[model samples]
Target: MPSQPPDSSKPKPRYTLDEGAPGAFEGETVTRRKFMTGGAMAIGGVATAAFGLPALGFALGPQFEDGTPDRWQDMGPEGEFSVSTYVPKVMNLVADAGEAGKHTVYIRKFDPKRDSKRNADLPYVAISNRCAHLGCPVRYIQASKRFVCPCHGGVYEFEGKVAGGPPVRPLDRFYTRVRGGRVEVGERFSLNSELRRFSVRDPSNHLDGPWQYLYPSRPST
Candidate 1:
């Protein structure tokens, strides 16, 4: 019977990264220059995101040069307006200025120069829905054939000229036209010259002029 003796001649293998280039594992930390470069890149990226892009947009994009907003896009076409029915709309005079500068105008089907007869010849005319007296909204009353302002009981005819009440003048009008089967209204402006001259001057002070704004000199209620 023969017994085999134990053999322990092989040395233990050192752990190494597979397929790595020589001297790649000489140091655990990255180079200082590389670390500084990475830090600088991160800071620069943050700075660019935080401030640079917005400043660039302010410089290159649309700037408010004269503090006045741009002209608003038109609400096109006046032909689509229905006859004798007052349709409410918002007219933008300036872009991006919001609702304050814009006006609430009403367009109805009627002839421009015709008087307020039920059987008038033309179709519709546009009028400012804002009450001439206190800048209140006016509603169309078919039964009375007039636009009635719920506030202070101002009344306007179909032509938007004032019929009665605290309103000193007619409702404001828009620059309106017909185009391509639609009724288009341009940016809001002051009332037509004739209406301004003869209409109620001021709702707040009706006796003075047709153009005065009501509540301007009135005592606080």
Candidate 2:
């Protein structure tokens, strides 16, 4: 059997009354009870959002917050660090938190022969000990010459590039400069697999390709 086409010339029923609905009156598109219920629901949703949205934002807003300092931190004399191996040093990440704010940073002299040519101008390589997977502390294993996260199996090569497990990107790095004969570590930044520098991102945030767009860099980065 052939299907019939819809009638475009016929006018649509604009009111419940026109559709012969029970408890409907002239010029009524909906019953009074339904209209009241819909209006009440709309008002309730707006009221809920007014209170809920702000609380939700307050809870999650810190993830996007930018509070990193611009001032450079003194690591030590340039002789303390070498080009071959990473030397771990403790530094304050959060201000005024005492011992709790201290974090471990690995520093080494920049070797132009072994490191990326793009970073040849850098005075030293300062890497954050935080794993890219979870915020777990990673220790540099001299035997394997790799950074291993104890919380997970996330592993990074000597250059901090992810070599295995669930890490999204490489370990973070800090800008280094020589001032007053001491090595000073500047702003913390992130890196891609190719060793390209990017704004600092949280653990598990990807900084390669389109994924980098999702975790947009904050101002503090």
Candidate 3:
């Protein structure tokens, strides 16, 4: 057989860019390599949005919504609490929908004449049972008139002042009001500044003294 020469008459492969087109590869017909790359990129973007959208919503959703309300709950009649003694009470906190949760509080009713320095008008005091050191439940010692945390050696005075050990500040106290012979408890506030001194005149101040360094300014959810 005779050897044939290369067919120079055959049409060579051609590539051209199309005008007025849309997309990352706009204006150009993509090659197999370019098409595969673009497909992978599109899949990656969809996957990222699938996982990222929910995570973003979870982190920032609470910030945009209305915060927890400060609703005063009726504990009971004032007569239920004995004078000069700590009484433990557990109450379920109500939220926007229904019951949020329950918390334990130590309520003390003081005699008006015994401690004139203490607020005579507000004779009732309600303190949180959660310890300031590490969020442990503190036990009240009637003999010593102090709260002792078993987790650590933290101790707090009857007035919720930090008496000893590792507690950065005193136990938090509830805002209280007496109306129609009933005791109403509201939001809890920490004794940040006033924990250093034992005085009813100075109450909890979140922005004062060493509280910024010692403990978190706000409670973690």
lDDT, candidate 2, at 18 = 82
55-125 in candidate 1: lDDT tens per residue? 55544332222322233234545654566566676776445668765766677766544544432422335
TM for every model, in the order presented, reads: 0.47, 0.67, 0.55
Largest lDDT belongs to which candidate? 2
Q: Model 2: clashing residue pairs?
A: none
1 against 3, candidate with superior lDDT: 3
The 10 consecutive residues of candidate 2 with the worst lDDT sum are 58-67
Writing each residue's lDDT as its tens digit, candidate 2 over 66-173 gives 535477889999989888899998888776889987888999999888888766667899899989888799999989989999998999999888999999889998
- What order do candidates take by TM-score, descending? 2, 3, 1
Cα error, candidate 1, residue 41 (Å) = 76
Clashes of each: 20, 0, 0
What's the lDDT of the predicted structure labeled candidate 3?
A: 0.65
TM-score of 3: 0.55
lDDT (Cα, tens digit) per residue for candidate 3, span 72-145: 88888898897667888886543443444778888877566553343454557878888877778899999998
The whole-model C-alpha lDDT of candidate 1 against the native structure comes to 0.54
